[model samples]
Target: MARIVVIGSGMGAMASAARLAVAGHRVAVYERAATYGGALGRFERDGFVFDTGPGLLHLPAVYRDLFVKTGKEPLERCVALTPVDPASRHLFDDGTDVSLPNASRAQVVSALDAALGVGAGERWGDFLNRARDAWDRTRRPLLEEPLRPDWQVLGRDPYPSVRRRRVLRRDQWAATVGEIGAWELADPRLAALLESYALAYGLDPRSAPAAAAVLPYMEQTFGSWYVRGGMRELARALYERCLARKVEFAFGAEVVAVTEKDGRAAGVELSDGTVVEADSVVFGADPRALAGMTSGRQAWAPGDVEPGPVPPGRFTVFLALRGGRPDGTVHRTVVHSPDAGAEASAAFRGEHSGRPTITVLRPDDPVTRPDDAHEAVTLTATVAAHGPVDWTDEALVARYADGMAAAALPAVPDLRERLLWREVRTPADTAAATGAAGGAVPPPALAGAEGRHLHTANTTRLPGLLLAGGWAHPGGGLAHAGMSGALVAGLVVEGDGFRGSQ
Candidate 1:
């Protein structure tokens, strides 16, 4: 059996390790932090618990498949997976509020029409239909399959554009999400709804390709889910599954360098001055970290190019409220910013917009609070990465957090009165914990933009080294990272010639 060494205990690393272990390989994982689940973190204080990472999971099938393939028990039997109905409630700037039905296009259309206007629902439905086409065209090549040698085909946008007559001008093809919203949706509220999807992932819809419309489509189609305890629980279950498969883990073991022998990866050197040799290596850390370790070696496979600047990280505020969650409250709510263009510019281009879009998550799960009298409210916003904005400045961080909290007041009435202690997590904290440069949170790989958005391939130029995390192909997001693990395992176990995950 090959002695496989995996770097970092992120979701993708653990997933790959578990699958490889099940495949009869001896897998060992080295994590820089003392815990697993890179970004899926939980913050607890005085019996109140808040998920610091993604509050909800979109496209849970990724994890379900992982559990089914790696163990005897299915995911549901292992973890309490519950569907979040009325998936999300949106509060637009114009006081237009709407709750979208989970995974039901007809219901969503009806609700939008009722809330926004007569034609609003129809326009949204049409946009979704176009997004569905994009999903169908690129889902396989961009997601399910491995990065091909001639990936330029993916550079060509697969989002089908509708032809419209223009006076004294050529018909413009929609390329960016913003263009799609402006050209097709027309309504400011509808445009905001579409752009919110991109912003939530730290993507700049203004520059993000029209394929980004698939973001909302995937969520609306697959539905959103939540774990009972917290998102952290999902990480716990995966870690447990890896242990069950006999994968060994060395926590607090920082991988300092990727050692090589005869021009191939030999193993990894830890910060503690110990070396663990392996037949193959799978990295689940940031690509920048990997580059530093290998002295900038292009572990990229043929036709793979270096990724552009990493996207921004998330800035979060965890609130321990004094009152219990009221009955019949949606799990997620988005408070649209007064100015979306300015918000996007600030986040993506560091334009410094004062009013940023904020997402508030209030889960009624018992595990989050100390008792029935308390509730945990998490407020998050996509911010510029650490360096340019200086997330390390305590005063600046506190001010930003306060601004976000104020923005969420519309959702949580009496927020200041129900006040309990509050905690702020900055991008600096993410960098310190996950080792992501500038605490940049990479967005999931998407098609279009001349393939500039796609991540580096899982298989590297080095014979025995591979990538298996958000930083790799298929890119970030809970589902995408899981798929990265699956793809890495397929290539390692089945052979480099393996096309994709089946």
Candidate 2:
């Protein structure tokens, strides 16, 4: 059995460890933080619990597969899945509002028709159908595979000149958001709706790929699901599975470097200068950070690679409030500003705009608030990466806090008084804590096939290494990250000659 070492305690890392352990490999995971669930991790403040990142859970089946593959059932350990009504409440700039219900396609159509127009329902149905087609054609080929060497292709070599070109076709769609905006939706509102999906990945819709259109379909068809207690429960369950399988976990142990011997990965060096030899090392954090940890510093030359534009980071505000829930609040709400596109552009260009698009999430259902109980609200808004107010000043943090209060809370007035406790997370925090480059969530935003060419799979780049985090391919979502871990385990098992066909 090969000794596999995985970095980071993120969902993907734990999942990959569990899969490998179940396959009879010796696995050890090193997490820099003193906890499991990197971005999926949670914290308690002022008697209220808040998930620091990734609040929503979707595509549960992807997670279920991980448990089944590991000889366990997700439902047996994790909280029961609950369907959210009005999947999302969209607050438009013109004072119009729409609620996407969790129901049948016909019901969704009826809801849209009632809100938009008589024929709008039909148009919505058509859009969903087209999106489903795209999803079916792409899901298995791209998301379900270990996107690596040209040999992993399912069929004949189509574009032999290009490497790893089996994922998508370059000429199929335009790579820029402006180009994709023109092709998919005619109405400006529709284009904005399309952009919302890209925004989920910390990307602007205008430059985000057209294939991202599949996001709405997944939400509309499968619906946005939630774990009963909280999303963190999902991470906890995966962590338990790793323990049950005897996967060794080294929490609070930060990896200082990936030691290489003769052009191959030898093992990892810990922060305390201890080296752990391994047959393979999998990085569950950002690849950019992984590049910094390599032994051959010159092997990773910045000039050797053509870097893509970094997506904007977030300015998130978490509030613990002591008051009755608002009358019209839902699980998730998107408040659009008059100039969302312009504001997003400014943010991408490292400039903060006075008004930015805002997304608010409530920990408790609006209809279920108790008489004297408090609610947890998470407000996320785009901010310029230019350090927020006088970039070099030490007081920039205070300025960011003031910015959140002045800009976000006014829109939802109860936010100020009901706010029992408040904490803010900036892009800087994400980078320092999680090693995410520019604090970006690397979801697959490649436009068409050519754009999807790069393999972000954490471990694919190195023969003896594995990648098990949101930064890898199939990027940035709890379920997708977990699936990536299982995929890596599958590769490891296959590589080790464990062929148990189902």
Candidate 3:
């Protein structure tokens, strides 16, 4: 059995460690922070708890596969997931509102027809059908495949023509969504919805590949979900599984470098000068951070690495309120400006406009939140990282906080007065804490026709070195990260090289 050292105890790291350990490998996970979950963790302040990252849960099958593969069932450990109807509530500046329900296509079309107009329903139906096709075509070849050289897949020449042909086919299929906004949908609202889906990947729909259209299908079909407790419970469940599998975890141990000898990974050196040697190393952190660790390595060069365009960063305001919950009881809300395109353009141009794309999540789900006396609400707004707000200046930070509050909680005029607690996080803080460059860690931009490739790492780049995080191919999000981990495990097992250690 090979000794494996995994850097960063994020969901990706933990999931991979669990799988490797279950396969009988001696797996050790090293995390920089004190906690096990990186972004999937929670912080409590003044009787209020906040998930530091990732609020919604989508694609339950990803986690299910991880648990089942590691010899545990997720449902047995975590609370049962309930479907969220009206998956999200969209509020527009012109007093217009749209609710996307978790329902049949006909139902969704009817709802759109009622909200947007007569022809809109038909247009939405067509759009969703196209998205479904994209999902089916790309899920296996692009997402599930390990993007690496494998002796099993490559029996003779590692760079075989057949493998190249498969890669090309996957790339061609992934590029289809680039026309969604410009050609696919004529209605501005429909186009906006399509664009919004792309924004989840921190990509602009106009430039995003067709593979992205798959998101709507997955969301509408599988349905968005929320854990019985907060999303952090999912991380806790994984942590529990890792323990059961006897995976060794070293929290608060930051890795400084990946040591190499004879052009192969030897192990890692920690920030405190501790050297831990292993047969293989799995880096489950941001690819940029991992690249930084190889400062003078010849196998990889810094200039060869090309990070994706940093998506617009976010400004968040957390409020602890003492008021009766809204009657409708919406779990997620997306408040859009009437001129969303203009607002997005302004933000992209590094302008701080009063209007922002706002999203709010209330901690009122009966399963997650007990009928307590207090309630919590999280308000988020997308802001340009290069905006006028001075991140280092404390006064500017407070001013920006007030600006976000005014824009987001205007309907609830007494929002500030009812607050039992308040906190703010800027892009700078998110970048530093999460290890994502510019606080917006998105995948490399979809490759162009000329194939202008980005040097960002893929899910699998080398033998025994697998990536299982937001940085991996098939890219970001809680569910995708977990799937990346499991996919890598499957690759290793299929190679017949994985053997568990006692």
Candidate 4:
């Protein structure tokens, strides 16, 4: 058995550690913070609780597989996973409202038709079918396996080529997401709905390739889920699973650098001046921090492609409400911007918006509040990653938080009056929590534009060194991050010939 050292206790790292341990390798995880889970953080004050990270889980099968591979108990035995019916309520600027049922294509179609127009549902359903084609074509290469050496083939857009009649000649099928929104969806509301899927994951729909359609297809097909308490419960379950497998964890242990011996990763040097030797190292950190640790040996993984601008980070407002959550309220609501394209432009340009597209989450779980008489709500928006804005400026952050709350007013009537207190979390908080560069959140790995959406490979130039996190292959999001861990373990355990878990 090889001696493996994993950096950080992020879900991806923990997942890999547990798997490697189950494979009979001695594994140790070192986290800079006092706890694990990375972005899957929680906050509480006076019995009001909030999930600071992702509020819902899509593609939960990723974690289900992790639990099955690592322990005797299944994921369901560890945490209560509830399907979020009417998954989300969309509040369009045009006053068109719709609540979509979870993973029911027919229901979603009917709801869209009822809310938008008779033809709208048909158009969206057709789009989803096309999106499914893309998903089926790319799922195995992008999610189930490590980044391949000949990854350029993935760069080819897989959104099935289409032929259309034009006034003068045949029109070429759309390439970028913006093109797809304008050409295929046609209806502005439909375009906005499609774009929202990309925006939520820090992807700029305007520039994101057409393959991004796979995102919505995955969500609407697989279904959205919620844990009993909060998403933090998922993290806790993962941590416990790792412990059950005899994977050691050193919380608050900061790694200073990745030590090398004869051009191979030898071990890691801690901030406390302790050196832990290892046969292999898996780094689950921001690209910037990982590069710093490598000390000029190699900065990027093979087949790594730059996706142009750095991805944005999340800005959140956690509200401690004064009143109870009303019955019959949807679990999540998306209050779309008046001009979503303009909002996307302003966000990518690092300009703040007084009216931004906001997502409001009001889970009915009792553990989040003191009692049924009270409620906890969370409002979030995608904002510029750390460097562009000074999120540390308290006044600036407060104003942004207020703007988010204001934008959410349509979804939550009398929102201001219902709030007893509020807290704001910025990209700076994310950076501090995950060691990500400028709190930048990486979007999940995608195909199109010749693989621009794909992140660096898990296997690096330095032997015995691999990556396991959003910054690595298969990219970000709760599910993809878990896949990153699986890939890293497969590579470490099976060596160079390891393609991926069957």
Candidate 4: C-alpha lDDT = 0.89
Better of 2 and 4 by TM-score: 4
The predicted structure with the larger TM-score, 3 or 4, is: 4
Residue 458, candidate 1: how far off, in angstroms? Answer: 0.4
Cα shift from native, residue 342, model 2 (Å): 1.4
lDDT of 3 by residue, 53-90 (tens): 77777788878777877874655465556777778877
Q: Give each model a TM-score.
A: 0.98, 0.85, 0.85, 0.98
Pairs of residues clashing in candidate 1: 299-461
Estimate the TM-score for candidate 1. 0.98
Residue 391 lDDT in candidate 1 = 82
lDDT of the candidates, in the order given: 0.89, 0.67, 0.65, 0.89
Score residue 470 of candidate 3 by CA lDDT.
68
List candidate 2 stretches off by more than 4 Å.
148-184, 261-263, 297-307, 326-328, 365-372, 384-413, 445-449, 452-455, 458-461, 496-502
Name the TM-score of candidate 2. 0.85
Across residues 200-235, which tens digit of lDDT does each residue of candidate 1 receive?
987898899988989999999999999999999999
Off by over 4 Å in 4: 164-170, 301-308
Give the better candidate number (3 or 4) by lDDT. Answer: 4
Q: How close to the true structure is residue 56 of candidate 3, measured as C-alpha lDDT?
A: 77
Clashing pairs in 2: 168-449, 169-449, 177-206, 177-207, 282-466, 458-467, 459-467
Error of 2 at 50 (Å): 1.1
Candidate ordering by TM-score (highest first): 1, 4, 2, 3
